[model samples]
Target chain A: MAHEEPINYYEYLRPNKKYPNVWCSGCGIGVVMGSLIRAIDRIGLDKNDVAVVSGIGCTGRMPVYMDFNTMHTTHGRALAFATGLKISRPKLHVIVVMGDGDAMAIGGNHFLHACRRNIDMTAIVVNNWIYGMTGGQYSPTTPLNARATTAPYGNVEQAMPICEVAAAAGASYVARTTVYHATEMDKFLEAAIRKHGFSVVETVSYCHTTFGRLNKRGGVVDMMRWLKDNSVGQIAAQKLDEEEKAAKIVRGVVCDVEKPEYLDLYQQVIDRAMEAK
Target chain B: MTETGSAENQAAQPVAPGTVSETPAKKKGPRGKVTVFGTWCKGCGICVAFCPTGVLSLDENGHPYVEFAEKCSACHWCDTHCPDLAIIVEPIE
Candidate 1:
């Protein structure tokens, strides 16, 4: 079910406010927001029935700008709050936005459990590879040997793969796409939201103001070009040798499996209890 | 700079293939005009960099201006992909 009206991005943003949003010029977070709006619009979801939740970060500020029902929750607790909202409302379309650090570091447990529970919700994890809001601190997804404010010399740890972790944690649907692939992102997001069980979309973005500057990755255009050149779709990546694939960010749907959603199972429990009473 | 607003003035010059760089195989039919909302745009140059056709160009201040509205092809690549959500590619009937 899609809207017959032509898509207008302005219709999704907060009325008469959040102009020139808090994101730095050329930030990828806004690209994700645009894709989200397009996906929701294409899916024909009413604004009032959708609840956008976000944890504290550059990405967290998203809910504040969107016109839909939104909650700006504590750092790393977006998924936790969203879980409660989803369970209680059950009918409201829930979407969670989190930064790399927020999802993989402080909120790591909640993220894993949310996936394991197979809750019906969409989580858009903006993986910018650093704690951009906190001034370029090295995040869990920062590539090995990348320079961050915390890892000035270099990061000793390998970057955590978000799609792989989500797939392993039992998320029914998992996909990855970079901001450069805007159309693909829109499609992936729509699919994730339409999935019956928990879905996670890892949006590979860059923190140009913080991460890019620290790493000397040039400017916004350069970063955008880099994303275009470095990312490879799953089908195309399959043809590349191991060494060639190692440097490329493999994108597209990682996994999709049909399964029972948490809410439906919970309804069964409630029905049984009522019958016993 | 003066030819910035008028589509006719900008379209007069036949775009040399070499000068425009790699102009992707143009999709036939349904051309559009690119509109920019200055208030919302942060002038990130995303629309300019990603426009499949050289239909957009950034001014000195970095805001995008429709360079060749005739060649837009209504791709919506710049409009939908613009980070600021400050662009709209309206099809001209």
Candidate 2:
């Protein structure tokens, strides 16, 4: 008989911190964390071989709970740190978790360049629309006309489609899924981790305490139901008219292509220079 | 709580190899056993509200429990949605 290891979710979690996470009662960050853990467990990755890095935000707290090579970097600098770490230790699987503001607003340049560099790293941007940790400020991903603490009347600027931006910047794997589609999010994360080049998985999360209360969205369940109602799979989305499609969040693997990763290319350049010498 | 077995009792059953399956097997036995870690549960009610077959419900204390194990198809909605990682679904032989 084959001896099977017990599947305990807590095994991946930090043993020191007792259960009952610090996030709000209905915050979706925990759900995203669960997806990440499920993905790692599904992939059977050795915890020592994995490194989880995060920028300062509610999402940044994600690494603290996980039993991995966790690093909490400065605000909006997770990608910069993760890039350096990935280049130095190419063997480790690096995952960067950032909130919307961390990824698109403060670290926008780093994010673009990281995708452009095509480095071997997976970025899971937990987009909760509003900056939940430092009070509800309007973020780069906040939908236009939505009410945030910063946007008392309504947000005038359009929301940034993170996957589209990553795809355009040349990320080899780019996918978008909401917290409501937890299974799909897990699969996307697993695929992103397995991919050899830079990958981006934008998890459309909800800040129920801030974004929900400000917008009068009932609660966590209501927010989840709204996600379910508003989202459409990419394939199915292709059939809808422009007007119809505009209202729905396109969820699926947006772009996936094989590309030469930065570290591997750099090594090849060094090898060529040595051969020439 | 009266209807379902404890985690130890459930652990005694044969273990399934992977995370909860997306597709339920067409087997005739009980779909699977779901165990909730009471302390870990934050009373979000996500698992209870989203269980497609209505297999889970919050007890008086707000922790979810398998209210109807027979109806559980092992679809894993509760397993995936539990923000606290409080629930685990295992296949029963």
- Best-fitting candidate, measured by TM-score? 1
Regions of candidate 1 where Cα sits further than 4 Å from its true position = A1-6, B1-28
Q: What are the per-residue Cα lDDT tens digits for candidate 2 across A136-197? A: 99999999899998899999999998999999999999999999988888889999999999
| TM-scores for every candidate against the unseen true structure | 0.91, 0.89
Residue-level lDDT of model 1, residues A48-132, one tens digit each, is 9999999999999998889999999998999999999998898899999999999999999999999999999999999999999
**Interface quality of candidate 1 as DockQ:** 0.41
| Lowest lDDT block of 10, candidate 1 chain A | A1-10
How far in Å is the alpha carbon of A165 misplaced in model 1? 0.4
Q: iRMS of candidate 1, one decimal?
A: 3.7
Q: Tell me the TM-score of candidate 1's A chain.
A: 0.97
